[model samples]
Target: MDAPERHPRIVVGVDGSDASIAALHAAGSLAGPLGATVEAWACWDVPPGYGLYLVVGIEGFEYAARQSLEQALADAFGPELPAFVHPRVVRGKASEQLIEGSRNASLLIVGRRGHGSLVLGSVSSACVSHAHCPVLVVHAPEEAAHRKKGSHARKSDDGQ
Candidate 1:
């Protein structure tokens, strides 16, 4: 016998950043029209110097991730989170977890950039390159870009 049908799922990375918030909104918009369920994920992992941090009582990684997830959802959906949207906190690398999630998702959505301290490509870039499903990279809002430029201009003017 054939397997029963399932609703399409859209996986989006939620990192509590404005760009990520935009991604969540975009995912929600798409989900409604596509009849897909949006799965918003906030992923976290131990830093490289985990041994030292562990001694310093940095064991609240999961809690912190969950907090970010909640905040992002609130920012994206206001008081009422859409019924089609589900929030999740994952304990792993963002790119790896999102890529794994893509295996079962109809679409993978992410921000164009994130607040990670990566020396190379950002998580969205990695997801675009590696996700099993089609990936959508939502850019930071125009006002944010303008604010960033204005701040840079002020700093440069002061330096000059």
Candidate 2:
């Protein structure tokens, strides 16, 4: 029979952005020492007022989310993802799905602003405020994160 299931689970919210990639890496690095499994979630949904266009269905959005998740995983853990990492793509508000996932998780991890504004993202904020478990918000490395956000951060404040 299989070993008894571990109670430790790390749920990470990934949106294929640099920040999310950082979160995945963080979860991976921590999972082993903690004897936990990482669940990386990439969630997507149709924008408001796009119901007409979406009449065809939601497969496209779901597919894109899956692709993003895969790419992010590759970026985070290289070509071969860690065996302890279980990735998932779900259709719903990220914050809600992540919160729901946290119900049985020991930890919930999210990027500070993956595919979002400079400050704390709506999804991250919601997770911090409502997730059932402890939350860790990670920020991506400087260059990649800022580039994806459509801006840049100077290494020196003097504008060198």
Candidate 3:
């Protein structure tokens, strides 16, 4: 008898940014073809200046982070997120959390740029260098459109 196939994990980093939203959709699109489960991780760090305030404010911080992750999903996948995708909010650095998650995941996906930068974000750079699994950095819409148009031009030149 054949062994049952194991469901693979596709972990994505979300931060309520356009890039992250794109990554979420890219993960969902890939999971459908690969028969994998999508795990959305949102990380938040308390400001260093808040010492004792950090303890008292932890709950509120976590709540906001969780809500942001939920909203990103809602924005990406409409009112209800797909059943195969699971959302998680954790307290930690975004890069560290995502790298840890990559340990057991089949694929790790992130956006080329998150909420922080006009250029590539630090988390994406770290993931590319350190994730245990294969990493896919989804580009912003403008970049994707440019890439698509370039590829189309190349294909047309072949006269097929």
Query: Which candidate leads the pack in lDDT?
Result: 3
Per-residue alpha-carbon lDDT of candidate 3 for residues 44-130, written as tens digits (9 for 90 to 100): 888678898765767877888899999999989999779999999888989999999999999999998744444567899899899
Pairs in steric clash, model 1: none
lDDT (10s digit) by residue, model 1, range 1-160: 9899988999999888888899998998899889999999999988886787677776598889899999999999998999999999888899999999999999999886644564224798899889999998887797468769999999999995
Report the number of backbone clashes for model 2.
0
Alpha-carbon lDDT, every model: 0.87, 0.88, 0.89
lDDT at residue 36 of model 3 (Cα atoms): 94
RMSD of each candidate relative to the true structure: 5.8, 5.1, 4.6
Clash pairs (backbone) in predicted model 2: none
Clashes of each: 0, 0, 0
Clashing pairs in 3: none
Q: Identify the runs in model 2 with alpha carbons over 4 angstroms from their true place.
A: 1-5, 114-118, 143-160
Q: After superposition, how far is residue 37 of candidate 1 from its true place, in Å?
A: 0.6
Give lDDT for model 1: 0.87
Model 3 scores worst on lDDT over the 10 consecutive residues at 112-121
lDDT of 3 at 69: 95
